[model samples]
Target: MAKVRSMFREVLLKQGQLSVEDVTTMVMCKPKLLPLKSLTLAKLENMQQAAQDTVRQQEMAEKENGK
Candidate 1:
C-alpha cells in the first residue's frame, strides 16, 4: 500500500500537476481516497490537461481584466 501511494504521489509530483505538500496532505488526511491500483496513465494525462486548460483560462481572464 505504501509503495502504491508513493508511486502515485511521485507521478503526480513529476507531472507538475500537484505540489508535494498538496499530495502529502491529501494522502495523510484521506488515505483511502485514491484508488491507486486502478489509476491509469491515460487518466493522469487527462487530469493534467484539464488542469492546464483551467490555468490557461484563468490567465486569459486575468489578462482581459487588466489585472
Candidate 2:
C-alpha cells in the first residue's frame, strides 16, 4: 500500500476499502457537573480573606497601642 507516487494520470475513484459505517443513537448521559468556583478563584478568595484578617489584626493591635 505504498504506490501512490503518481505523476497525475488521473484517479477516477478506485481506492475504497476503509469501511467505517457508524449508526447514530441517542445517548443520555450525566450532566457534566462543574465546580461553582475555579481553583484559582477559590485560592484567591482564601488569600484575600487571610490578607483581610491579617490587616484587621494589625489594626486592632494599633488601636490597642493607641489606647
- Clashes per prediction? 0, 0
Among the numbered candidates, top TM-score falls to 2
- TM-score of every model versus the real structure: 0.41, 0.57
Per-residue lDDT for 1-67 in model 2, tens only? 6876867585465786655569999999999999999999999999999999999999999999999
Model 2 ranges with Cα > 4 A deviation: 1-28
Q: Per-model C-alpha lDDT, please?
A: 0.72, 0.90
Q: Which ten residues in a row have the lowest lDDT in candidate 2?
A: 11-20
Per-residue lDDT over 1-67 for candidate 1, one digit per residue giving the tens place of the 0 to 100 score: 3534453443424454653353444334644576545558778888999999999999999999995
Residue 60 in model 1: shift from native, Å?
A: 0.1
Position 30, candidate 1: lDDT = 41
Q: For candidate 1, which ten residues in a row score worst on lDDT?
A: 3-12
